[model samples]
Target chain A: MSVRHALLGLLSEGPKYGHQLRQEFEERTGDVWPLNVGQVYTTLQRLERDGLVESDDTASEGTQNVYRITGAGVDELGIWLHTPPDLTSPPRDELVIKVLVALRMPALDVRDVLQVHRRYLVELMQQWTRLKEDEGEFDFALALVVDSELFRLDSVIRWLDAVDGRLKRAEIEPPVAVPELPRLRRRLAVRR
Target chain B: MNVLELREVTKAYGEGMAQVHAIENVSLSVERGALVAIMGPSGSGKSTLLTIAGSLEEPTSGEVFIEGAPLSTMSHNEKARLRRQTLGFVFQDFNLLPGLTAAENVSLPLELDGMKAKKAHTIAMSMLGEFGLGDRASHFPDQLSGGERQRVAIARAVIGNRHLLLADEPSGALDSVNGEAVMRMILNACKQSGVAAVVVTHEAQLASWADRVVFLRDGHVVDQTVPPPTPEQLVHTAQQR
Candidate 1:
């Protein structure tokens, strides 16, 4: 669901500021859609601009900006929640795009992917151990997640080994590394 | 109506076979306009305590008051009506109807109580507006982002304006930004409307949003801290929990 609708929908229970809405969203959904705090305020600003939500005139002293959904927003949200929106084809993710390009880049990219998974598997295993100490059903869920991560990591690691053997048998030099300075710069800028 | 009350309450899940004690001698009170959080780990009996207090599921053995009267001897229908009239729930999952709009989702709780469509929708629309979903109210769940879905869920939960707000991981699916916003909004509503709230959360950051934070581990309140520590402490507590 759209964050905007979620914000407005939540306000239906009562009026709330931006920060409050973000917390409730996570609490209700089990951290399935973690929101950045800045995004919550930004979205609220947009909603207010559209007259979908209105904030109180009071000067709140917290990071949360006080806002409540507007009547128009309710009407619009009502329509959208019931009516099916025009469907767009699923967009390709970076993983798919990267994998497609990896095929022409020799087997090194495959090894890189394997490395990432191996690290992730280790992390998940660590998390699972810590979570079990807390004594909750989260352990059950984490176990499943850890299992999947390990399984994926194992598969990738195996594939990497196979690729290594094939390369050795072929006796071919590995692909030369290419500097991606521009791409790295763009990524760093985007992060900032 | 008193709705629910706990007197030095303690709840344990298993007997000698597999004893998993969920709550330990916890006392809480929920009247009208009372929203509460029973924050704890997965096995913590916060849910158990809530179910018993709400009279949805009985406590292993505790004195639960409903509507100024005792529910200890009430029938199933009596308890059901009590639940319908006094309590509303918001699950971690946004349980909105696929066919329903934002307003429709908000109106469900009231509608279930036999409120008319016109009346319910009117209230629902107002509720949606209150949360800020006005302009794109007609957009379906698919068209909405994660934050929007959560907003819809909150609206639906509060549409009935039930006195007690029992949210289980209310912001579980939201991003930190969205999650914080949701918590603030819930607390504000509870504060402004004087709805006593009990929100169950594993995140101390979220729990800090509450007026009081009673930390629970292994289904027991091991500590109670008012106000909060610095952001570091809150974060540390959350991570440790």
Candidate 2:
């Protein structure tokens, strides 16, 4: 998510090359988010250009340039570690959009659409649970990552159930008739 | 042979104008060593199906067979014997006898079936050890934690030569960590001991441990599917990325 801040945080420990940073990043994140070595180098270059990190090209034995966090980099990482992520705005969720669109279609039963998606989400949650079960007891990082995903999916399911309940209580009437479209009529006439 | 089979089973309550079908025309079969999970909203007949399958309740129509023996033909005593020898049950509440130690609670089934108390206690001790509860064998149900109690219950469920297990929200009383641990134990029992299991749970994540998941809706089977890919397959795909 914030690979720049992550790279800076890793460098704040000590001087490290791009490949080593990538390894530590994967390890700390519990391997859920795989970091590409090339992307790591690219972020390092951007950090160097921004003066948040300094690369010591002369101290390296080979062509691999070791990088260290600057004073500004440490300040930025510290700020990021304390700042809470922005969650004020509602996310653009595909499932929510699908349900909204399905409500307007007379031919579609919105409840059926909800059930289909609910089943899929449940299956996905199951997969994550299996992964958690297979993980070792000492692997707290990965377990936490899996737990977060499970909780997130569980919330989505709860939302779907709530919507279903509201719809049942509302007893909204179905469309009286399918709306006629002039464009469809024109296309049918041309085909004939 | 299939450990449990339901042939077009329909369970109805009341009669005439007030009749209600709890589960209608539901057919399912569970092979030995396979675990099946049934999930649905409240009053969706998930528990009804489980009870009928376990032969605790007779289906109003159709038939149920366990290990190829039709339940309709079994006499009352025969059914009781089958339940004692061939079936095991796990409930949401641990259901251990408060007065008995864990070892006695687990060995009660065998002792009821006429096994010597000493022999049953020895077998129960070994089973508790397998479940990592050997030291807790002397403890009462009230002395063990929720997870430990559930583990002891499971150990009791599969302790003897039980061929099938029927569980109703066995992990409902525990938190997510302990819940998952209970499911892991159930999965291990099914896989390692070739025990056919039918579990009724509201949590889909717990159901995912099963080989198949059956969804119920308003007294009818809505859908059934094999669970998603195994953890090994998922990890392999992630690594490829």
Candidate 1: deviation at residue B79, Å?
2.2
What is the C-alpha DockQ of each candidate? 0.02, 0.37
- Model 2 lDDT per residue over B1-241, tens place: 7999999999999999999999999999999999899988788898899888888999999999999999999999999999899999999998999999999999999999999999999999999998889999999999999999999999889978899999999999999889988988898898889999999987876886777888887788887765689877866666686
User: After aligning candidate 2 to the native by TM-score, how far in Å is the CA of A66 from where it should be?
Assistant: 3.4
**Segments in model 1 whose C-alpha atoms lie over 4 Å from true places:** A1-192, B1-4, B30-36, B227-241
TM-score of chain A of each: 0.46, 0.81
Q: Which tens-of-lDDT digit does each residue in A1-192 have in candidate 2?
A: 899998998898899988999999988777878889889999999999999999986764667898999999999899999999998554568988788788779798887888888788777777877787678466888888778878888888888877777667567664466444325556667987
lDDT (tens digit, per residue) of candidate 1 on A55-157: 8866657544567778899997898799887664443545445544664576465535533543343333333323322322353443344334435544543
**Stretches of candidate 2 exceeding 4 Å from the true structure:** A12-14, A49-52, A60-63, A70-72, A136-139, A171-192, B236-241
For model 1, state the Cα shift of residue A180 in Å. 45
